[model samples]
Target: MSVDVYLGLSAIDSRRAVPRATKCHVHLAAKPFVVVGYHLPGDPGAPIGLLCGTRRERPSTIVVGEPREAKLRLARLANFAMDLNGYAAQFMQTPTTSRRALHTHRPANGPQLVVANQATAQWLCDVMGRRLRYLRPDGDRPVHPGLPVAGAHLSFFAGQRVPGSSLVLPLTEILAQHWVTGQLPSLDANLASQLAWITDPGAVAEAEDALPAGPVPDPEWETREFSDAIKAYHQLVDAHPTRADQPMTGTIHDALRPSWDACWQALDLLHSLPPADRARDRWTQDVYQWSRHAERVRSGQAYFRKRPKQLQVFRYLTRLERLTADLSREMALDDPLIMAGHVAAGEALSGEVVTLDLSGRRPSLQVRPHLPFPRPVGTDLFWHLPRSTSPSGPAWPIVRLTTIGVTPEGLITLDVTAGAVRRDRHDRLPQPGQQVVFSPFGPRDYHPDTLPAELPWTHAEDDDE
Candidate 1:
């Protein structure tokens, strides 16, 4: 176990969240659009409320007075959709001058959608995106123009849910990355509970009349407060078609205030941590993917399809695996705290250089590992090279290991059995007394992304247009 994870296990006694990172891995925009969403207890497609905005003063609240009614559900989304469109428009306004990205060749730099948890992300993309995206604005059963537009965008965000995509930032998941709470890992999905652990480290579950940070509203609050107000509001709407219920909006806003505040509080905590050195570079990839989706949408081509072929699944899984490995390696390299896990597991080690010899036929270095973990001779450990701008080449194996003093210290002697390096390249090499990390980890194998031919009816859904 890593130092933090092992320590976090014992943290149960102290009831404190253990900090897992010295740097924030997720990209946080200066003004990311935070969306706190909720749905009816049993109703997946019917959204009960959404609190959203870039500014924290007071987010624009949208609530479905009666979620059961299909027309009302879609009708309420018009305002929400308009907000999404307006936010996205800011990204597309800047024209790109480069060749289209192979995936989505648009620009780099797109809007970010922050939600409470993964369930809310599912609600936005799967249930809600599917419900509104296929609606024909000009069809016989026409809906608001903004509804389909927002649905399309939300659908695009769903596609961007690969490992480390910044387009959709689930607050709970991101916060969990920075700090592992003493609460059950399952409870980490609850934004309110997680943030409570963060702000008040020893906080425990209490019988407070607080709502969950959710895609589902509190059932008790519904039976005691919301059900009656919503029933009365719908009745009033039926009686007076043109009347606006000013007080009901405030009520909805009040109901959501706890979770809404928690979301921002969590964001503020994340903002306090230093971001990873490569966070911006990773965000650029996110924006690039967003631009590709934008291009597809502008082209008016069908997107959703039911052709989940075997080949497509294989390709997708392969990509996911590659991305996951790359993200983990990068996270460790950029943050020593993360790399400690490998050190604890004996897959990696760190220490100051004791000596270096260039007089022999090959370059060699003696390193006394700080942890003194025994490693087999001839193990190939790549010296951590975060600044290796050169193309990938070959690396040789270690030739010796020795016991220093009588304490059995792991003093390793790594010898390059291949060609010797030029003296002029000494600047790039690790010198004596320099601290360095060496691990078995290496760059993933390179392969061309050439798909097999004879693939059709496997890209998009028939309903997509």
Candidate 2:
């Protein structure tokens, strides 16, 4: 945690309330396509209901009148699948030439899928992918072509929920990242509690306002109100098979509506903050990835894998670690508040230049700051030059730490080695009174280098048996 976050938490404790950050630090391409619903608790493979849409008022809600019928449940799911697929299809339908690669085709943009929490996203992807991926349109019990297509698309998005992509977002996770609540992280997982802490502290004190956002409802509510509603709907279906199942849909809608509204409200909060510079860059990469998956689907090669091969698993883990570090550095460089944490942790430091020895054989300088300094001499650092000429231009100039000592007035002195600057580029160099920030990340790219086009025989396991 940064000193700012520490100080903010202390203030929150004193005031008994959490506060918003100065700006949003997350990248959001557009209003999120929000999804809120519950699945059968005991039957993991069966979904009880789902309410989802791009807009809050226009969401389509589906509840199974008979959850026991596997085909019936899957048919209802197929409807939702088609709807989600249709929404996502807009991004995949059109192809444009890649700006970075002349001969390659890329999508204009990608769809963003938002869920109540991380578990809901994982559940939606894993369970639905298994149920629908292999369904055949020409088989005896034929399924719609859209069902498998949707399954592949949804599975692709769920996999995209890893560190760098903004395609699949969890509302609670994003909110907690930008704000620290007075309560524990466990409590923050509850959307209602987190929103209460953020918008109205008094709401947390009342039971009525803090409703559960769930794939599982509260046992008390489930045992009484929700149970009664389901029973009544079944009774109506039994008495008049022609009548609609409004009662079941209504109850599930009421249960999910608060979180539905909360997801949009949280979007507004996250939207207020300016996006990090690399956020859009990462999203563009997501578009490229999505387009590739869509191409596989179009080519009749989109079979969802239940388990990745050993080589693929190794590659995935390695990529996840690298992406996590890349995201951290991006977030820190984008927001000063986030960088402050690194400063507190001694991973970075910020100060004003004190002395410049530009005439020396190896040009160097000294810096003085009021903050604590813990690094030994000879450590390397990068300075974020404030006079960056373009929005996409490189801002960090690399420098090495050379010396550390206390002066007569008890002030810390940091000496740094640097290369000679061009006379015309004097404006880019840090002058003695200018405040500067330094950290480990600089102009170097951390993205994994592209591997060879051909797969090695070692990675292709034998299936001769």
Candidate 3:
């Protein structure tokens, strides 16, 4: 969170709304597929209904008429799988070609999936995928053919929801990244509360018009409307199988309409702001992963383990941490508003060059930061030069922090140790009064070493060997 956002939140005590950013934090596909659904309250593993499509007005609905019946449930899932696969098929026509080592033969533009929040994404990714992924059409208890396909795709998407990938986007999480609400962070996860803070001042959290966007419906509403509707539906179906469609459709539409409308409104609000620049590069990475996953599926090698081993868990956490740090650095560099948070926190500083000491043997430059430094004297801070500063085209130009001290007037001075390779060329050195910024972040890479196939034994295999 940024200081600007914090101040905004403070100012909005009366209205409970604040704008944390001037631009969108995440990238959205030109035509993104929005999904909203609810599962049975007691049995969250069992899905009740789903509404999905690119446009809200023409969204398709899938409802499980007899959820307890495995065959009937799978049939509904097969219908949804076909719809999703068909949407993805259109992007296969002219796949973006990349000669990169990893993307030799994969589509560059894959389908993007969106949900209301992280919980909904997890429901599809973990719970739903686990339930559907392992069923085989040739097994003793055969299942629908499309169930396995859907499971594979869902499992792939679940794995892709790491820090940098935008393949499986969570709208509430993305919105929270760019805005701050007067309500508590826990309450902001509710779509209605988030949207109310962003758009309507008069609307309260969980307002009647802006109902809960749920994979789990509200208990009171479920008991009243849903229980009656479903009971009536089952009675009609049992009596006349042909006439139940209209009643069921009406019931599903009534339940999902509020959430479905909220999805589009949230998207529209996000679309109005320009995307953060680093988002495109991150999305490209997602495309590469998506292509590779598609190839694996086509090769019949797609499989997601129920749980990872001890070593695999360690490696996954390490990679995830690295990616998350890299993402934070990228976001700071891409947006000044976001960087302001770091600046406020003393993780970064921005100011004008005060003096140049070219005559000295080290040829160091001094900078006076406009922001106050919470760091102690002698603490090192590196200057992050723009890529344009280095003619050799380094991704990030580095400057070693030789010394830092505070002046009598409370301004901090930075002494650069080793960034001036082109000291002779006056153009290379930052001119006095030229604004510069520095932080702990520079250029770095993380590659986890491959684990050995066999664990080394501390002691001999006793008498068993």
Candidate 4:
């Protein structure tokens, strides 16, 4: 009878084992063949075997073929042996020239190899003993010695003293077990799930509503998304030069366009509001301004190095105006009072000058006003004298007034001189105490004391210097 043994997903040739049993039976003449399982001892090169008890009454010469088929029978007979004196027969899928199996099981699953006859099992155990001596006494050392240790195993395996029979498990399962057992701390599942929702674009608006209304909108999530979109936009522009000029129609561009438009709309709405409304809507205004500023910077329209000082000054002035308007609304002050205060401040800032002492020389004089005025105070002011004109000698009389008040109708009235000059035309005469002294170089030395003292001459420094 042809005997067939089926292993899951694999087939083995059993013809050799069948013949050995039949010969044993025939030689003993009706004595039953006693087939026993055994394993070769040691590494593949030096396999030796030991006797196992007989399965029947016949004295049998050892037989070993594909070893997988005999595992259950050998273990049941109590006849299996490894590392003992017996007739050795070795059966391997591939021949082993060395004392050990040349290849190990693939890492994707694991290794499973067994020996079937008792004599072969003992031979395997004997051969493996020599190889094991060369290995660290600890069985934890790799089966294939001299190979570089895997990085995952290095920390636990290096210099470890391993005992015989202890298994060296693969790192993959060890790490997985550690994580599953809570040996490693993990993020709270509910918080992690909520954060995922918060990051989702569909849920960002709802998340924002859950947060408090601050001076500016909660921009953390929007900013990250906007930044990524901006990077992609720049990359697109760089990759295709014409894309810059083309209307942005791509998905990323379309998504960001609405945000940009919303920002601009907010800014415009804030700007259009009256001062009273702006005061009540300060939080909205702040958010709008912040968005506007960020947009200007992002668009490269307001680079710090590229913006002129004058533009910076203008922006500062505009900010100041807005703040003052807000304060006025808060204080419930009328428009006229606000305007008067602004004009008074301007006058106070400009009312000062220093006259250069030119008593001994040809009477060339220099006048420096402490603050810049929009235009010259008089059409025929001495400093405005013709550049090509000649000047007289050393002590020509010079009149310098530090403060001159101008009426809304353009009347130039000096607080010190107490004299008003109708300064509507270039040929207007200088009033008393406002003598224009001419030198060869032009208007020169002047006596400030000769003018009236009632002028607002609040000098930054005293003349005693």
Candidate 5:
């Protein structure tokens, strides 16, 4: 009995604006028709399916039961193949055509190619090898008619093709083993380039270990460092060269590139900063003199002259103040002025009877008089009382210290209310029901006694006072 396979390509869904097309290749014999959704049927007609190029529209189905069914299936297959070939030609000619055009044209008596059964498909593969090409309707092009289409039944051939044994291996395990053992040449040069950009040495090592040993070209780690590595990583992501959307190497590169660049920038910034105060002092002095001169002009009688120039001077002063503030904060120093070389000028007045030495290092006294008191080593905790609740209603000194504590465990305990007090030890932490005041560093126990019942200082009743 002669057996014929009828292949029809059609879209998977009917509702899409353009349906997604797939190819169903069905085999038929003279007897009853049988279709196998999972396994290849033993009977006359069994559909060994292979999806053709993806389409934006639904594809027509092929029926292969009786003579009429076979003729109809053959005709549909022939039309589909011819339409696919024509679509491929059009796509090659004008690449920018709308996806709707993918299935717009139908061919007359579409071409038919005959194969006996699944074995014939494999035999054809062996005979044609890489030379085999199929008219892919959905892709709108010709593609290698290998396992993706021909012998797609290999996935179904699992248990039936193998000799009867008590144990049955899964198709995935068999394919994985074949992939590991198979001597396929290294990936194409373009693919290799993509791997180089996206795959790290560590990931490459893992992939290599999973597969059978092969010639792994050295990963040029040295040459790829610094700027080149960043550029290559970005290129890999942009091109998306992998057949699989979520290739392991692509994932590794995506994660590593940004983190590596950030580390590089951080290192560069650290290297830019001075290692010692001596180096910092030189930069500070130049900045300080520029700032002071600008400040003097703004405060003096010359402030009103050259208003535009004064604005510029004020801007410069603002920048200098910010720089000085940043340096002081970073260095954890009381005063940045000590590094501004102001101390050196005071030494020259040593011989004078009324010599004034401004050499002593001190915290900025702009807001208060310099008091001869021991400096505190910890944070000066304070709070900004909301204006509405304050005695004077919206006034200064609304800022006041709510509590004081040692530097190390400053907020181990707090008295938040007029009479209530809460205590916390390293071992005995406060629970949810207990009111707690949270510090920027972490949570703290709120002591009710510490909190003032109301504003401590009352506002004067009259505005004249």
Candidate 6:
């Protein structure tokens, strides 16, 4: 079992969540846009309400009195989308010397969506984005102009779900990385339950009275309150064509208030934790991706086909693998405690250097792994160079892991090969007694079979729109 999981299991005796991470791995934006949204459970694609804003005290709320009514749904989303799109719009104003410079002189970190979990993201992205983005302004079922823009942006945020992208951060996932609760992985997805265990042991993890943090309401509540509210809304609207409809919207908003409050409380909890060193690096990638997407939108080329072709899928899969590896390498290098997990797994080791031979054609070291696991000769490994002045910052570098000699006691002498030592100008090789760690970083050590440029007939691309 992984160290984090082990720690979580051990935490059961304590009756509280165990903090696996001292620093927050996810990027915490300066002004993260908190979003707590709900949609109809029966018809998941339809949004019922959305509460979003930057401030803690005041949040802008939007509710659709009738989820089935397309125009009303689109109308409610128009202002909400404007609010969401408005978050990104601020960063777009800062002009660049070149159509680059990461979009401006300042860091172009877009609006970070502090949400309950991936389920909430899907409600906003898959359900909302897919529904609205393709709706033509002049179609048979015309939509407000902002709805499509909102849909496209929402889809973009969802697409940023690739590893290391901080645009749409599900708080549950982030909280899991930092603190491991005693509950099952499935239960961890619930923000209120997770926070309950994290905040205070005496606090109830699951209360009978407390509402579930959701994009979907509980069946009991829907039957008891939600259904009645929707029916009342329809009757009131039918009675008066132009009467104020705030009462109807207010009813739905009140039901979702608990979840909305939980999302904000979750953010406040995250804000209390310190950020990881490599978090900035990951956030940089997010800003760059945001800039590129913004430029595409500005160029009027912001369109994602309902069905993407083969090449697109292949490229996306390839990028996902690459970025996932990058995140792992970054995390290992960024956190020593995290690296210790690698040590336990036998993928890496840490100990004082027994012998150092920088004088050789290839710089080398011989040190027994702190936790020795039997391995065959010539296993390729990487030297994790920590806190190096290089831009990569604490890189997992080096070339080969050549087992030069072995003894009957199971001790091994690993001869480091060429291209191993990559350091800043002032950074020299480790001395005879310095501690170090090594691991097989996928991108560095294992060269997976390269993808062919020409596609097979089955996976071939087409000019499908």
| lDDT scores in order | 0.73, 0.71, 0.74, 0.26, 0.25, 0.73
Error of 2 at 98 (Å): 4.9
What ranges in model 3 sit over 4 Å off? 1-5, 14-16, 91-108, 205-209, 385-392, 396-401, 407-411, 424-429, 447-465
Clashes of each: 6, 2, 0, 45, 22, 1
TM-score of every candidate relative to the true structure:
0.87, 0.88, 0.88, 0.15, 0.15, 0.86
Best candidate, lDDT-wise? 3
What digit string (tens of lDDT, one per residue) describes model 6 on residues 1-465? Answer: 889778888778788888776666778787988888778887877777877888767788888888888778778888897887888787664332343354224374566877888888877777778877887788687777777887888888878888888888888888887788888889888787788888876775344246766788778877887777777777778777454356656766787677778777777777787777767767766777777778877777778788876777887898888788888887776677777788788777566667766665566667755777555677766664443456553343345556666657545667656445443321345566677676665333445647677788776656583
RMSD of each: 5.0, 3.7, 3.8, 43.0, 34.1, 3.8
lDDT of 2 by residue, 1-465 (tens): 656567568746764434334445455756557788787677767777888888778888878766677887877887798788878877765453464652133233678888888877877776776667778888688987788887787788777878968888888888877777777678777887777777777777662345577767677767776678767767887687655367778888887888888888888778777767656667767777777787887788877668877666767788898889888887787778778778778878677777766564444566676477687656667665543446464434444444556566544454444522444444545788767777877554656546545458876677894
- Is candidate 4 or 6 superior in lDDT? 6
Model 2 error, position 411 (Å)? 6.1
249-346, model 3: which lDDT tens digit per residue? Answer: 67777888877888888888989988776677677777777767777777788878887655676667887988899898888877777777888888
TM-score of 4: 0.15
In the range 1-465, model 4's lDDT, one tens digit per residue, is: 111122101111311111101100000111111111222222243111122222222222222221233442132212322211121111111221221112121111111112222222232333333223233223753333221111111111111112110112211121121111111113111111122221233443353344211111125533554345335546665677455322222322333233233222222322332332112233232223323333443353422222234444445455555555444332222122222232233331222222222232222223232333334443222222222222331222222233244456433333222111222221322333343321112232232323232333552235588
Worst lDDT 10-window in candidate 3 = 99-108
lDDT of 6 at 446: 47
Deviation of model 5 at 197, angstroms: 27
For residues 1-465, what per-residue lDDT tens digits would candidate 5 score against the true structure? 100000001101211011011110011111111111110123222221211222212222221212124333233334333433343222222222222332232111111122212333332223221222222324654343322222221211221222211011222221221112111223211121212212232343343323111112123432333224334444554566342223322333332333223222222322333343322333333223323323432343212121234344445455555545443332222122221111132210001011111222311111111211122323232222212434443321111112223224222212222111222211122232333221111112233333333333452134377
Q: Supply candidate 3's per-residue lDDT for 62.
A: 86
lDDT of 1 by residue, 1-465 (tens): 567667578567567777788898988887788888778888888787789988888799988777788898788888899988888888764443343332234234578898889988888877788777888889689988888878888888877788877888898889877887776778888777777676775445641236777788788877877777676677788677555444456667887877788888888898899888667666777776666677766777637753465677778888898888878877886788888878887878688888888887557777777785566666666654444334353322212222223224546777644222556544445789999887656554668777776455765345656
Candidate 1 accuracy as TM-score: 0.87
Ranking by lDDT: 3, 1, 6, 2, 4, 5
Q: Give me the overall lDDT of model 5.
A: 0.25
